[model samples]
Target: MAFGARARLINPRLGTYFSIFAALYTALFLLVLIFEQLKFDESFLRIAFLAGPIVIYAAIGLCVGTNDILCYFAAGRRVPAAYTGLLLGASALGGTFIVAGTGAFFFSGFDAVILLMGTLTGFVIMAIGLAPFYRKFGAFTVPSYLGRRFESRGLRVITAGIAAVPMLLVLSAELRIGGHVAQRLVGGSANNLVFLLALTIAISTAAGGKRSFTWTGVAQSIALFLAVLGVATTISVMVTSLPIPQLANGPMVRGMVRNEVNEGLQLIKVWPMAFQLPPEGFSALTKPYTQPFGSIGPLAFIIGVFAIATGVSTAPWLLPRVAATPGVYEARKSIGWATVFSGLALLTISSAAIFLRDFTLDAVMSERLGPLPQWLHNAAAHHIVTFDQAATRLGFAGLKFDRDGVLFALPLLVDLPSAFSYLLLAGAVAAALVTASATTVSLAAVLGEDVIQGMSWEPPTTQSRVWIVRGFIVVVAFCGAMLCVTAPSDPLRLVLWALSLTGASLFPVMVLSIWWKRLTVGGAIVGVISGFVAGAFAIMMGEMGTLSTPGAIAGILGLPVSFALAIGTSLMRPEVSRHTVEMVRDIRVPGGEIIYDREMQRLQLRKHSRT
Candidate 1:
């Protein structure tokens, strides 16, 4: 009872939750404010900007969900697919989408909104692969599923390795982009030193395990939803004229073509930066969407998406939630909705960011030249800080592309005050929390179940399991943080790089293993290897602007080649078991539904069919 009383006093959720919530926003907001008000050194701002996402992400990642058996509700079976998808969509969009997607997903300038929408729409169809099929198996992660299906440690080892790489790579991109977005939101210099940000994420992630991190997701997810709503409303009010922003950024581009307005739309000019005009934005190097083509054609885009979809499907982070769901149906429902929501957000947000980043140059100029009294301007305008030292600014900080005069892009981008902006930022932060929490918990699961005890064995005591996860959280966080020191500049590219790796290694094997009865272990091995190799090759080609166009054509081709090899080998060999074939029949339904049953007699009959 004494301990219980102490626990209540010390482990307060409501207050700590809100405080973290407020701090998350305030810390990020303050960084932007310093620049608008003080005109601080850009280097410092870059360095400083890294702090919030890392810290907030870490803090949220450590929040736990009590698993008193009751905590493991039958969400998987009970929740409708649509509702599950909604939650997933909302969760996957996280902080970055809120900041980058909503802030930038406008029809006015860069036509960025359109690009993101395309990605989202494509993903909607894509999520189907994961929902029923993955849910049916009742596996938590891609690798775990591989382990279960193959019953081959060799296969599981390779798959796990393949799956983990992309996650690590993408985490770097997320951190970098968060820093970039934060830098702009703060104005000039967030003083967020890169190491500071890295350290914060490391510390926070290391704090707890699955128990602590789930709530962090809840807190962050809630914050993100609210923030997006607020920002969405604010953007609506600011541009009462352009109804197009609501329709989708791409449509506006089409309208531009229809009205011949696109022909005359001049690129916004911000000093020290050059962005693309709408007519040929992809061709423009200065624009964020500019493909790293090195000189390749449009086909690279297709290849890139296919790889991203195939390679990065079963994130390590998404597994535990799969475990927690009530049954296969619930899990399916969640994944389907998750795909759509994430896809939409990715599309809308990406397009909006491109639009904002491109057009904001002009917006900056207008804000500067417009006739409002200087004093009447927001607080950011009233004060400005400047830094002179060159070497000092560049070291700890990150890149800041000032798209124009003093009123820079960051704060304007995030100044989520009033009704909408604040809410949006909150949402962005919340999303960050969700990803962080999910990732941390998933990592814990991996370490506790896979690495420490092997797949067949699980911890006997909840207390022991919790401690194992907590210990691993610290170790993993340290390693990941160290990687962030060498983080890259272009976040989008970085994300793709990691995702492509996944496409190469794991995509084909999983698909064939689930869909085809004749697929053999040898075939699975060949497919994983060949597909991975092709994926890597494709990524290089796409990045270099070489073999692409039908978009995802590379992935389509790569997987088939890999699958063919696997099947050819399987047919050549004799280990093709009747049991495996029977297992396949049990899972793959007309609509691809899976039902779980513990009844031993029925299970024996099901097993007998395989023999």
Candidate 2:
């Protein structure tokens, strides 16, 4: 009774401490907003506004640091539902959403909306189908869950490799995007910026692992949402002359589309019909701006949505957050909160893209009579926007705008105050940092715990395991940073690729492991391998010019392939043991010991016996 009393008391106090910490950071963020409204030197304001939040994040990580592996791996499994939900939302709203997503919307029109809807639907599926069950099962990592659920160490190793591929690829893309933001704000070579950002992510992640990420993720979510909301709302009102941009931006967008159509028609009269083209080329040759699918097409749009939604539902980086929740109820509730928050942010992002597109057409593209806007001038100076004289006759002078630069360049295009631009940049960086940190930690934890330990006869000591995770964190960070330097891809494309791969390779297995008792070890292994290969082939086809556009639907192919293989192979193989069957049954229902510390449970049992 005394031990139980002590335990209950400690958990609340820990909650209180983190609550206070979060409140302090929130207060500090408000103060920064106040400061932004005041007059200050451009460079000084930029540095201070940008550095303040990052320093606070690092400080939080340092304060949260612990040697306890459970604390490091799962934030002691005591994180509040609200915070975990916010972290998941923040992780979902990475640089791709804030930065590259805007450009995608600019180019693809309503196709991007479908993708956002798909992502939100994924969260709903997670809340209803996966999160609660995973929390009940109490696995620290995805591979660990799969390994125990299927009773196969080799499957665990294979899952780790599959998880690592997308995580690393996505991390590298995020780092490259973050580096680009930093370079624009502070001025440095892209390679150096990537290295520095990678180091910062490594330090913050290694400092306290998931504990640090949880706290920092809340702050990041707030910053990113505010940056996006503030800019979009203000710009929407400016364009539409209405109080609510969410509702009011429609007419403005329509007018802009009409203008683009008129310009395209004028071009066709002067040049050949084939020669007059939209910015996205052949796929959007007719009424590009007004079309629902634009260059992406309807099939691709539907596939992209499913691929992204499934990806979010089964993302390895996201699953651990669910496991860290305090109970099955909270785990389920948290997914709803994450979905709501992410949905709001996406709404703001899509609105901003439409508003910015209008601004680009009126202010930047049509300003052929005089000097370009200061924002466009600076963007061109940075090589973010380039002009090609050869295509000038088609009503667009090959005004090649880097999609990744859209979010960063939006403020400048609208002539917002420099302070606001810096804040936007900081938010982009925060978004990247949140996702990068989570991915890094997940990579390390899975590699160390599932791959290395699962292969060994004798497990390492707790301290050794902790060190192993830390070492993997460093190695993964370095490798991802190097990839950022040499093989940087578009942030949104890379994110979709990662998501599609995860959805194809892991989502089916995760669902089956929790709900399907017939899932055999051999079947799971074959499913993962075959799914990965098929997904990779689909992406390769898109990249190699076989497809008109990148096959966002590759997961559509891979997922069915995996499902068939798993079902077919499981039928051919022996049934899993009754013990495994019972375990699955138990996980399906709610109400179990939420805290999953095996060692602590053992000690508590001993104490009860002695009493």
Each model's lDDT comes to 0.46, 0.74
Residues 81-197 of candidate 2 have per-residue lDDT tens digits of: 777887888798688676777776766666568657877988988898899998987878898888877768899899999999999878987898888888777875978978877
How many clashing residue pairs appear in each of the predictions shown? 75, 0
Per-residue lDDT for 149-214 in model 1, tens only?
765656666666555565665555455444444443444432343334444544554454433444
TM-score of each: 0.66, 0.86
In model 2, residue pairs whose N, Cα or C atoms come closer than 3 Å (at least 3 residues apart or on different chains), thus clashing, are none
Q: What's the CA error at residue 25 for candidate 1, in Å?
A: 8.5
The top-ranked prediction according to TM-score is: 2
Point out the worst 10-residue segment of candidate 2 by lDDT: 268-277
Model 1 global lDDT (CA atoms, 0 to 1)? 0.46
Rate residue 100 of model 1 by lDDT. 37
After superposition, candidate 2 runs with Cα above 4 Å error: 1-41, 241-243, 265-288, 363-398, 456-459, 546-552, 594-611
